[model samples]
Target: MRNSSPPLEVGIARWIEVMRRNLLLASIVALGVFGIAAVVIAKLPNVYRAETRILVNPQRISDKYVSSTVSMGPAERLNTLSQQILSTSRLEAITTELNLYPKERQALGRDRVIDLMRHHITIDLKQSSDGPSAFTISYTGGSAQEVATVTNRLAASFIDWNLRDREQEAQGTTLFLEKELATSKSELDALEERLRVYKVQHLGQLPNELDANLQTLSRLQVQLQANSDAQNRLDQQALLSRSGSYDASGEQGENPQAGLRSQLVARDVQAHRDLAELHSHYTAAHPDVISKEAEVASLDAQLTQTPASVSSRTRRSGSVASPADAQETSIHHSRDHLAAEQRQIESSINNYQSRVNGVPIREQEISQLLRDYDTAKEHYRSLLEKTYTAQMSMELERGQEGGSFTLLDPAQVPDAPIGPNRPVLYSMFLVASLVAGLLVIALRERLDSTVKSDGELHDILPHIPVLGLIPRISKTIVNRSPAQPTLRRAS
Candidate 1:
């Protein structure tokens, strides 16, 4: 509080007074900032965002493995496939359809507005912590309604496109499987027809699995033929035995060797030849008669001792120890030989019949095999029919193009301005004002310099002559319109 204060305070007095002339510079800075901000706010267009949502569901359709002849259904493979479809070229194609690009401002035909348009358009896919079962897709743009419209259109279009693609695939698959089914059916039909004809020709015979049956039948037939042959041999022996009494000249009853034997049995030979001695010595019905009877008994006993199935006459007449018995014995010997040959043939026929009894079981097995073949053929035919039906459905679906994706929602008018963020604008203005105030103070310090009073001027250049000096300007500067009075004199 000394009267002179410090020398430093006096030195800064002129600088402080010069710093106060800051009005004009502040006005200039304010006007410039305000003009630029107003132009930026007026030219900028408003942008708006809109959104839409939908749910997609899947369904089931099969027995064990869900066999399909055409393209498989969506529900069968939706999860992984749907995601792949979403992020594919199919989605990019939408951009082409929508013509989403900016308009240019240059003389060149190129568009600068396209860059701004890109900034306006935004596509976002939202996932949740829950699961991958569902997701959301959103789009934002210059207008809220346009965003909603595009989202819905894209969603519908993608669905229709997916359907069309499936239909085409189905048709292709159907055609391929159909050809196979047709060929298989043709082959099956041919086989069945041939089998039918074979059965008809063979009469109750099934061709499939018939080798075993045919073999068994052949063996039976052979056995029957052998039995017939054996029977024929037996018959021939029987006929030969019966015909032993006949001569070889085809006569029914004549025996050439029987002549002498007949004579030996004849009453005249016995009476005339053997009676010569008897007539000389004995009367009829006396000792001679008894002796003749004894002789007849002994010859009959010899005939009875031979086999009944053979010719006893031959055995008994073959050798009468005397010459009187010789001629009749030869006929009996031939009869006995024929009877033995007949017995041998009969034994052979019996042995053959015993060896032929194992042929019915094999025939039954062959019949069963034929049944199995028929069943398999039926199954093959059924599959062929189903495949054909599927092919037809696929073809129909393929023919239909340009499916759904209809306009559920279209573009709409926007309501609010989207640019020139207000809080940021005001904040910028406040900062500009502070900077302008500081700059004005600095500029005024350079423009105003005074050495008016005695003490202040003597502070520096004290030896210079002090003439009557101009006083420092202490009057308050009032801001006014340019048309008003203003002080222009130098200090």
Candidate 2:
């Protein structure tokens, strides 16, 4: 009896049986597909690839001392170089100059050719433990010589572009720093000028001069006080000289009018001294000045009256003029000089006091100016330093001493084609053909209802009982002669 397993649960033996029944059909399908693949692969054109390796050389000078203005890393630099070199205009120029892709250009136009060339060109970065240390520029083409030339051209373009870009960046940085420095300097100068003008406008009243101003004011005050004391002493001396000379009994010695004249003279000196003191402290239009002037005028009137009275009395009484009269006149002149001196001292005191009082306001103004000036000076100094650095970097780039690309390995004509590796492709196509053959076998088996296996028949009729089996007759025995048909056909 046959096994009753389902047909869908096929084992290795069942799979072998299925494969055997369709082996010829499977072979024809697989071989036919493989033959077509072999023909197509053989007819395909050979593509050549050429590469140029470039090392990303750092600045010759140490970065610690003269850092390059361009701070891009190796990978980023290569990418930027790739974009710039592979730009439409640049590629177009290279294509025209090198006469690259001439057939593609004719067939597909300039734009399409550029796209194809771009696709064919590749830039691959080589990274190390440190970073991307080098990169390769490769171009694929039909001809080895053309690919090598184009690759070398691209490498040259990258190097040249890196140098030119670095220089421009350095120069641009320098120019920007210079402009900022100029602006900062202008601001600093303006602040300085303002400070100078402010100091000049308020010479004695600046913050730094506050202490000196106070000291000066104190000195002037003392001098003024001393001057006033001296004036008082002169006043006493003048009074003493104007008084009449006494006899041995301390009697009035000269004319009787001497006593009245002495009194008038002392009053006049006191009034003049008071007027000078007031004139120092107040302006001409002040009330104190007005009052002092009125008092002085009254004293002058009193002097005129006393002198006239003394003269009349002296003439009427036939009294001799005092011998001390000339001394009295000289003393009066000295008093007048001392009073003028006192007034000058008092004026100086007032001037210095004004300066002292203005210290706080001037100090505030000057402090503001100083703060702004200091800030601007700092900014200008920083900008100056940056500008100097940028200039040095620019010079370094111009000298080709900064970060640059060195062609480590120039592209050369390849002896062998880089693509259409026939053996690998042939193996891959062989796999695809096998898969196609399996698919065809599966489709053919799915559509046919013929039960080739007892397992398949059992799957369709699970409840059926098989009591006996009919053995398959061999084709050789069926084609045998009928003369042997009466004999039992048993092996």
Winning candidate number (lDDT): 2
lDDT tens per residue, model 2, 1-491: 34565545567677788899899999999999999999999999899999989998878999888877788877887888788888899999999998987878878888898899999998888888888889888999998889999999898889999998889989999999998888898999999999999989999988788888878876766666567667667777767754433322143444455566677767866876776576546544679878887887887687777642243324544766554555657776876787678667767766777887788888888889999999999889888988888999999999999988999999999999978899999999999999999999999989988977666677788788656556666768767857455545553
The C-alpha stretches of model 1 lying farther than 4 A from their native spots are 1-19, 60-102, 105-121, 126-152, 162-180, 183-414, 418-420, 429-491
Best by TM-score: 2
Q: What is the number of residue pairs that collide in model 1?
A: 12
What RMSD does each model have against the real structure?
18.0, 7.8
Clashing pairs in 2: none
* Global fold similarity of model 1 (TM-score): 0.45
Q: Estimate each model's TM-score.
A: 0.45, 0.72
Give per-residue CA lDDT, model 1, range 222-307, as digits (tens).
44344334433433443343344333323333434344333333432233224223422333345774576466455445434532
